[model samples]
Target: MITGAQLRDAYISASNLIGNEKQKVDELNIFPVPDGDTGTNMSMTIASAAREVSRFEDGGIGQCASIAASALLRGARGNSGVILSLLFRGFAKGLKDVTEAGGQQLADALAIGVEAAYGAVMKPTEGTILTVARVAAEEGKSAAVKGASAVEVWEAMCEGAHRALAATPELLPVLKKAGVVDAGGKGLTLILEGMLSVFQKGIVIPSENVEEQQPEVSVKRAVAEWEGEITFTYCTEFIVGRGDQKAEEDAKNLRAYLESIGDCVVVVDDDEIIKVHVHTDGPGNALQEGLKYGQLLTVKIENMREQKRRAEEEAAAAKPEKQRLERAEPENDVGFVAVSAGEGINGLFRDLGCDQIVSGGQTMNPSTEDILEAVQAVPAKTVYVLPNNKNIIMAAEQSVELADRKVVVVPTRTIPQGLSAMLSFDPDRPQEENLLDMVRAAEHVSTGQVTFAARDSEYDGHRIKEGEIIALNNGKLTFSEKTPVKAVTKLAKTMIKKDSSFVTIIYGEGITDEEAEEARSVIASKAGDNVEVTMVNGGQPIYYFILSVE
Candidate 1:
């Protein structure tokens, strides 16, 4: 029998195990694009649930599973994360109201999870995580029917998962060509193996071993002549228990009060709690005002000036810096949210009518909650989302269910596609009409990308070397060159069709205006005088240039 506590322990062990092996799984990615985040996304998704589960001191097996399922859904990041969430959701459904589950019940739960996962995907692919899970569940069911113990059932499931994972290369030609099994399947097998370890060895893997290492902080004070005083000294955050108070009315009052005292105030209230974030000089006053609603569950106050000084010092020490984006209050009928990286690309999206821009693409994929937050910030009844990257589209779609506004995710696979889609938008037309027009516009445009190869590999008979500029024609690797200009020019020549008249080259962060112009001239020379070439400062990372031909 598996009790609630043991089940929780098993999941915790699984998260830690996956975290430890995440990089190994990441390296298995064969897709020529640099977005190798399946392992990280799945690990983070499960870790979110583990953190939530750890908070519950007392709960039945069903209650624990439900808590995990809810957290997984909300925290899901990429396609793998969403699929993992659906699997857990189905598992939770099977264990409803059960204090404990035995072998047969556990086996049935696994099957249910597999079914839910397969059902969720629009077109389920074989040899991926889905196949591995399905095979494991089927074997578990068989074992249970033969009157096996819970441990025996789990053992059978793990064996089946391993076998399925090994056979993935046979099912997917890409895997065979890459000389690797499915990354998602490998990740899933590691998770199941971790769970089996908990049941077999009575050991729970600790997260501390695989925890991310924090950079060393060295506070560098500025030269005495240019010191500035902080306007809002204190950063205040607290959560109020929603005891007998009406959440909506009290939340409104709380927001008003916080706004009066603070510069940056954000109050989010639910039936159970009222969470407050404010930047004010007087932290004591903010705490006093918060107490009027309910008892304060957690309180945190920090000196902003000190924090800022430390951050500056860290920047001076050569540490990477992260920019924080502020959320805007909702206020329009139709709004747009786009995902992209680089200041130039972000500015283009804003200028082209995107209300909110999420900073992510390629190597960095934003979570569903990140998109949902951006959606909520847009004060529109209907909001349109442009995911800009193919890998990010599924994550963006997951935000629709959680968003307060009607979210329509336009499947724009490239930044140029997103820009083209935005150009086709008509405010006067109905949403469905606009959707069709935007989708059509995106489809009509051909996209090409130039980026340095992260590793040396041969794909589709092309031998690519590390540090070489690689050209991708609509997500497929076409050619590799020693120079960006050669790659972009070659890519343009291939992308420009018989009727293609316009060519747009968006240069990234590494290229200067002169270099970009030279690249543009090279492209123009290759494309002939008939093609009208335009160059823009995209300033995006990873890719040296993004090309669009229509």
Candidate 2:
């Protein structure tokens, strides 16, 4: 018999197992859209249920499964998350009234979950999580039909899952090309392994990461978010030894003093030590007050303003573009929505008359929903989207279907192409002519990038190593260099032609001012006097420099 308590613990173990190894699953992605977040999405999807189930003390499987299904549906993040939620929803439905499930019941539940997952996807493909789940469920059902125990059914499911995962590449050509199994399949196998460990061995796998500071962190964030304006700049914490009979009086006075200088004050004391946590403008004064009680054992100070700024940046990245774009009814003739990564790059698009700029590029590709939100933010009859990165083009296209107003996606695979398209747009011309001109303008421009290799791999006969400086011409790896500065010059020279009229060097965040000037001088001298050389601070991430030749 399978109990709700065991299932709850099994899922918790699975969540942690996948969360700890998400990066590995992410790396298995061989697709052009290289966000590689399948593991993270699956882990987060299951974690939603795990967190909710942890709160309930009920041992009834029906009640526990219902709560988990509701939580998973609400918390599902991406495509993978949605599929994971669907599978669990089916599991809940199959075990609706069953408190303690037998081998047959468990097997039937697995089959139902697999069926629901397959039905959820519009065009279900093989060699994915669906395949893994389907195979596992079938194996479980087979074992159950043969009069196997619940433990035997689960073991068969795990065994079948591993076999299916290994065969995923054979079913998907892209996986074979990339020499990796499907990321979603791998994620499912890990989850099953974690669950099997608990169901078979009665041992719940512990997470390496401990949430020791979760309570304090929640309190800090709650107070920070509620206060529109931060009154205190620093967050200070200290622990002091309790000296003599006067320690309690000093601790009481310290609390009062902290309350006067800070908004959130927490002073806890025992017979041996006095612990204090406060947000204040002056950390020095806070520490000095703590010293009066006894010798300070531990002292920590953090700038709240900096932390808040970082939090805002992360929120911007997660939600939508950082630019202040207001949603309005379609009133104007036409507007533009450009996707870019850097602050300087976004500013350039804004200056070029883009109504909204979506924050995204390469590895951090924004979702279709994010692109649609940016499109809706524009107050134009027709909105044209320029996805600067190749990975973002598909998402930008997807937004066209959901947008309230007319959305025409001009597939700009690179930043330079997007800029060229922006430059070529003319209000005097008709919409069709303007679109045609933009596409042609993008086609004429050539793009070169200097970036570090993310991982070591043998691609196109080139033995690439991680951390190696690499150059890409148009979209293919041209060469590798020892240094960023050297790679910039090498790639620029390779891209420059005798008839090329303009060379624009867009330097990113990590490139120093001196390095930019050095590259500009070398390219200017090397490309010769006829071709004009110019440099601008792009402030982008990933690539050190983006060379544009026209």
Candidate 3:
């Protein structure tokens, strides 16, 4: 049995371990897309739990496990983050209401978390986190049955996780093609090794040499003195963890919870976790309630009014200094950053309160360094990042570690999800509550897109020819047609299904206005009478049309 402090230290150790080797894990991402962010996802996910575990008040092993579990869930960002959160959540459940956890309980907890993660995903895929976690839990269970101690069980789990991680490439051809293991799986193994490190060796803070912080401005400045023209204020941020309760509509319920607290909220939900952001007055209460569902991590708050006032003063001062375009020094309060592409998309994110936008997409993936600069540029107590593309999630995640201030990333896999997530923005709401709520709301949306095939392949029994327009429901290619409009219409029809009530079509660049309108009409006809259709100009490249259903 371990003490609460020991558990806390173990989590911190795990975080540092994963943080140190994030790039290696990132390299394992199978997708050739520039935004492969497996390492970043896992690191951010564990970091959320690490923050909670590090700050746990003196308590028994159960308390520590509970805290770690909650924090992991709330801080979960992508598929990887969500899975990591579940592993700990299961650990908490295994040790619930107990003073200390022995090897048996720990093993049980590991198994439980694995089950929870598998349960959450709509379609469980092997060769991913699920495989790594399942193997580790099994090893832990087998070791515990042999009268092993907690440390012994964890060691078994660590070894098992590594073994499983190593085998990921064998299980998935893409991983083999990419010449790497599963990024997310390796990340989980790193965390387990980190936990084991504390028990075997000792807590070792990542050296400043390796754990670099974003460079800070040389001079100290007033909180309200740095802004200019206050493009946006209220740099609100929080970390949310997953809750243990097996409640129906957990995501939807979380969304309702955030709605009660704030507005301007954006929530993105994946199989494993949810990421959220909002503008509201109750950042503290939001975080407190967020704890009920998960653990509390780092937080940041800024006064929007103060930011505006400072920006005005700076703008006035710059005029006297004869500075044209008035250098918009980063504010000292709050700031925002997002990952996106296209002028229209950038403008949309900016209008939604983002302070910085990193240009990226399916083709042009941003590197970790690009995202890191954006994170560092946002001069605030906390910085919020939105990785609107699944491929970019890892890169955006890596930026958090390189940043100086608190950083929370909302994993938005698609532009529709990104925009919908921001709709619930509430700077005043508690960060945790908003995060949970917005993420839940995002899950309600269904996404579709039309793009020309990049390669010839047989997917889901559909034969595709390169250069032909392909329509996708979510990420799965469903239709291949000669014209963009026909392909897009087919995707929109699939997106609506029977229950969908609203349909949105975002026309991209290279598409004529008449073609977009024609595509919309096809979807309208298929959607029946009650479904409403709305169209907009995204002016994005690549995809001919981005369709969304709610």
> Which candidate ranks first by TM-score, i.e. highest?
1
- Please report the TM-score between candidate 2 and the true structure: 0.57
lDDT (10s digit) by residue, model 1, range 159-276: 9999999999999998898899998898889889878877777676655542331111111222111111234777788999978886568988988988888766788888889988
lDDT of 2: 0.80
For candidate 3, which ten residues in a row score worst on lDDT?
Answer: 213-222
In the order shown, what is each candidate's alpha-carbon RMSD? 16.2, 13.4, 22.8
- Taken over the whole model, the C-alpha lDDT of each candidate is 0.83, 0.80, 0.70
Instruction: List, residue by residue over 274-303, the lDDT tens digit for candidate 3.
Output: 565655667665666666656545466776
Span of ten consecutive residues with least summed lDDT in model 1 = 217-226
Cα lDDT of candidate 3 equals 0.70
> Would you list the clashing residue pairs of candidate 1?
330-379, 331-379
For model 2, how does the per-residue alpha-carbon lDDT over 1-550 read when each residue is reduced to its tens digit? 8787777767777777887787888878653323427776677777777777755555677677778887776555456666777777788888898888778888898889899889867689999999999999999999999998888898999999999999999998767877999988898888888878777986666665554111111114422332223568887888998767454487789999999888679888888888898889988998888888888888888787777666555544655545545678999999999988888888889899999888778666565657788899899999999988765664566566567899999988899999999999999998899999999999999999998887776666577877888888998888899988999999998899879999999999899999999999999999887999989899998889999999
Model number with the top lDDT: 1
- lDDT value for model 1: 0.83
Q: After superposition, how far is residue 387 of candidate 1 from its true place, in Å?
A: 1.1
Q: How close is candidate 1 to the true structure, as a TM-score?
A: 0.78
